[model samples]
Target chain A: MRWSLLGTAVVLLVVFLMSQRQQIEVSYGQSPSSPDAVVEGEAGELSEATVPSVEAMTAMIDAEPVVRLPGSIARWNERVVREAIGDSDIRILVAPPGLDEAERGRVREVERATITIVGTKVSGGVYEATADAIPEWRAQFASGDVTTLLVPMIRHLQERESPAVDASFRWREPTAAELDTVTAELRANGSHVAEGATLEGVPEASEKAFPDAEALYVALPRQPFGQPVPRYGPALARTFPDRPIVVVYGSWIEYDGPGAADFAELVSAMFYAQFGTRLATYDYPQGNVLNAWLNRVTDVRYAGLFDRPLPYLPFDPVKVTMPALPWLFAACVAGFLALSARSLRRPQAARDSRHYSRLAGLTALAIEVSGLSGERSDPPLTRGIGKLRAATEALESGLPPAQVRTLLDDAENELDDTARLLGRRDYRPRNYLEGRLG
Target chain B: MSASWSVWLVGGVLLAAAGVGSTLVPRLRARGVRRRVAWSTARAAIDSAAVSRDACATRVAEAERLLARAESIAADRGGVLAAEEAARCAERADRLWRAARRG
Candidate 1:
């Protein structure tokens, strides 16, 4: 059983390690062709245009409707887009709006180039402008051209299509009393309260206020996105009802040290809650040792500009297949149980066979000793030999020891007399023989 | 879950099972061996005692038979003392046999 268990453990460990290796290889984007070879081939084509700076990439992301730009104009735009998104699972690619025929051709070329360079497949269609653009976007989505629309316009359209609540109201900063009331209400309903300027900043604020809170309540500005948009509070509340939240409409217009500290704590707490212990808190744009040390000391991670938290991409689910180990483990366990049962059920008489064998051996030895006395010719000795033989036979047949002992006593007396007649002074009686044998 | 996390979870469960099996299997095997040994020892003891009692009973029966024959011979010779002595010997043997059997 020990061996079986050990074997199963070892097999599982090996299989698990192999599966992890396979997953790592897949995640690292390792292809049949070397990465360097592909990069070098693409580099020559990209040498004519300089790679865009990080600031320029950020500008491109901020300016959503980049109209009528040639694909080759933004060399390595795909790389920039991927870097900006970090590790988000991008299922569909959306072309920038306002593309003429020449620009459209460039966009297609850019898409193909991005696919080739990344060595990963992506499918999507060009975004077309129309008088009825909402229906056009919906049509593209329904036709599966853009399977996962990440554009803010798509979110706005969805909100318009299914208005859950009317949140149209003038913007205003909340008072201290209002904040206190909201915080109290959230606490009453079993929530950890963390004050923030907007819904986007809550993650950072909650991290600062309570680093270990599983759920948190944060203040939401009346116009969080610079406009009277949808009522996200009720929807968020409904979605995470078990994780009750209380939103106080307010604005932290001015930044201060205390506010920044609170934001840092909230971000830390939110990240910890979301990922659990697997993730390490690292400084944003992590490279410098000094920054890492400072971040660690301050317990702060980058919460982003405008006090917005960084995007979080959860790890992909893992699928594992172990064809034989489970069956083998079950078989080993079953075998162990069966063997144990069989061992327990053995016959009691069979187990006691050793005692019978010992008794038989002792009786045979006694018979031999009597014959060695050399009183075979005497009638009394002959009678004693016959009686001893009878007793030995009875013993071999598992006869009662009391009867055998009685017969042995008589045989011993007769044998002793015969021995004396033969002048044998060394002859011992039955009691001494029985004691020595026993 | 991430691939590494999944592997660790499975490895933990397997290790726990292995630990349990390692602890329990040896104890179960020892218990079985001890039970079998105890059973064999008890059987041997009972059988030995029974045989000893049977031997005593046989001795008592032989003594009784001798007493009866001696009494018949003495009666033919008109000797009451010899018959009485044989009867006493037989009675004593019977008593001893009964005591051994009871034990």
Candidate 2:
């Protein structure tokens, strides 16, 4: 039974490990790839590197159409567009001023499309260039919901898109700590971020500031020091409801620590396109899988980020849970000894062995002899032994074993030698050589 | 049909091996290759076989060293992909050696 239990446990362990390997996901869109890109050159704005860049938002806007441009636009432009909000999985549609009823009336058209809104941080610049580029605000707290299904958009849908936000380099100092704080909080919660020694050869100050970033994740932002901002496609397919999708410039984000060699694996997990990374929607059950993957990376790569270590999964073989063998052996030996001592006794001469048995009723013979008149009975018994011995030897060897019995008076003996010996009978009675030969 | 008994019996043997301190991970990895070279090389000596005293001592020693080195490498720089792989390989080697030693 013990064997069966242990066997089952071992088999189960093997199967479990084989089936549940770890999964890792790399988050895209965080920092700019290089510092050089921040400085615009004669060619125009300095191009961002391949790292995913997040656009900033100044204020929220309602999903209402107010055409600022007077030029006649195409039918597609006039049609309602459904666009992604922030990182949320929410979608919003902006209808024309008087077309609210018409939009509701055209069920088929409404089914086909809705107005799209890009919930993003507007950079400071274009407002000063022209009134068309002036910033607008709305009281409605409009945003996207980044569900398993929908993705967020950080910018406008385009034919002729709006220009950049207006702000002078001298006066503009927009540095929101919210994005950094939220990311750090998640890493802390998941055990992915760790504190470690500073490394050399990093090209930016962030290298020292967040020196203890996940190795695989930190290395991503380090690649492509200077170039056009690499593409970060939309994270959602639709304007997801209430989810905040962060759109950073082109930069690599590490799931594991920088030392992780499987960054290629992270890249493989997502779909890449001109826009950005998209974590596509799957079946309802798959959200758990995604979360599980996140948990795995958090654990599997969580080693270096902290001083005190995390406890491992319950992978060690249960400490041979059965009672110990040595204890059992000790108990058995003790019991055996107890029984042996209790049963110890002298050996019985006339019992299992035929030689020992049938050696006359020695006690009965002695009693009968004592009852006999004035007889010590020793001599008679001795005589009986001689006769028995002589017969037995004669039968065994076809010759008389006792020379005295042959030379002297021979007894017609029916008794056996074994009985005579036990009774101590004298074979010779009062003869000159009495009892010598017997 | 219930050869569960065999597992227990084997477990006993394995326990004895562990108690006797013969497990080595590297040798286990090297097993079943090159004429099952690990087992052959690990045998302590023909003379020792007579009493069955650490018949695989030599291979066990070498395998242990390899496993330890691998473990050290893995402990540091574990975040990198290459480092992580090496660490896993080292862990495997150690486990294998331990199995062989136990066997």
Candidate 3:
């Protein structure tokens, strides 16, 4: 928890510092105030020269160089990069829904910034080297929207939520009452109007006012018959050819290895998704996060007093400027949390109190069950106690409870007494002797 | 026609794969660590896992060889301690040989 908190603090600090590009640039010997600092030719000193380390000849031969056998022994002495990185995971970009103005700018900024950062982190993001050079690299995809989407997509990866219409305003179409009200209000200023939903479309009608050229067609689609998959994509495409159609669909998010077989399978699977009428598909791949979110969804409920949008403040989703620092800070925070969780999960001899509690319960159970017949006039009390004790011992030794019970039963008949004791009065002593003799 | 083609193609490929896997399975098994003598750890560790009747004929022969050597050494003026040591060693060896052979 402390590690996660520290990680969060570090991420916030990164975000805060990154917000001010001035200080962040200084780390890489660049001054944000002077753009010329980035120029390779301009500098106080020419450049840093590579330095060579000198080692003693005797130390080289005498030293028992430890070689690491991967997945087995650790070699602190041997410091060499592994020749191959195991199992490269295929990265899927799932863009967050409906980017606010501020977020969109941040997206663009990150896209530009990734060109520099991607140069260092994973040289060639499997997409291309020099993020700017990715254009010349792709055969058909050149608009660079894919690269633009990757940054925020990777940073703010969330499971797909139900696609919803953001806002809807409704009015009874061509209502006589509504039209009368509109005309009464408009005619007071000496204006006339049609009795329809067109009263609200007054602002948009001046551009398409010719009655003979175009007819007002207000039609709603009938319910689909067979497949429930929304046919709205092609429907809208036919209705409005010039305007672009955006279709959204829910998808399972999971990680897939980058093997050609898996890649081909995914490609083939996507071909069938066309019948589902999805305009464009984006892989969300939040298996790790979705499980956690699902758990939260099941267990937790929110009652925040006000909206605390992560990237935005004050007036919501408006003419806002995007800041790059916050997103970077969030990334650092997430990384820190992940690392802390992974690191701290290491096992110790620390036992859970619940485990000890369970043991104590079973011990008490044994004490109660051991001498069950002791208080009564049960003759086979010692045998019963012995059996119970044996079962308890088996339990203590970690045998299955059922097996212990069975074993206890197996020893039961051998311990039962048929004859009565001497303490029992009422002419039972003679009878007890006879029984014993028999 | 398409369905049948797909079925036949997948079937042939799977059959070929199965044949190839069977051929390589033995080699892969052999590459692993060898088993111990007390119990079967992987595959064959001892000459024979199964023991016949009271004791193995081969185990008796080996035990006899060791006993014969100890006898010859004792013949050339052996001390009480050496004789006792020899007796203990023979007993342990014989016990192990018998147990292994029987097991």
DockQ of each: 0.02, 0.01, 0.01
lDDT of 1 by residue, A131-192 (tens): 12322222221111221222322333233332222112223444556545655655565332
Candidate 3, B83: how far from true, in Å?
45
lDDT of each: 0.38, 0.27, 0.29
Model 2 has an lDDT value of 0.27
Worst lDDT run of 10 residues, candidate 3 chain A, spans A72-81
Query: Among all windows of ten consecutive residues in candidate 2 chain A, which has the lowest summed lDDT?
Result: A134-143
Best by TM-score: 2
Winning candidate number (DockQ): 1
- Give lDDT tens digits, candidate 3, residues A1-438: 634544555554544445445333322221112111222223211112111111221232124221111111101101111111112222221123222334323323322222211101111132322212211111001111222223322332222332211111111233456445533543353222233211222222212211122212211111121213222333433443433222221221111121223232343233223211111111112221122222221121111112322322347331232243344444444454465446445234244344334334333433433444232223233333344455555545444345354534422331322112223332132342245345
User: Best by lDDT, which number?
Assistant: 1
TM-score of chain A of 2: 0.23
Model 1: CAPRI class? incorrect
lDDT by residue for model 2 (A95-159), tens: 21111222223311322122321121111112111011111110000111111111212233222
* Model 3 CAPRI quality: incorrect
Off by over 4 Å in 3: A1-389, A395-404, A417-438, B1-103
Assess every candidate by TM-score.
Answer: 0.21, 0.22, 0.12
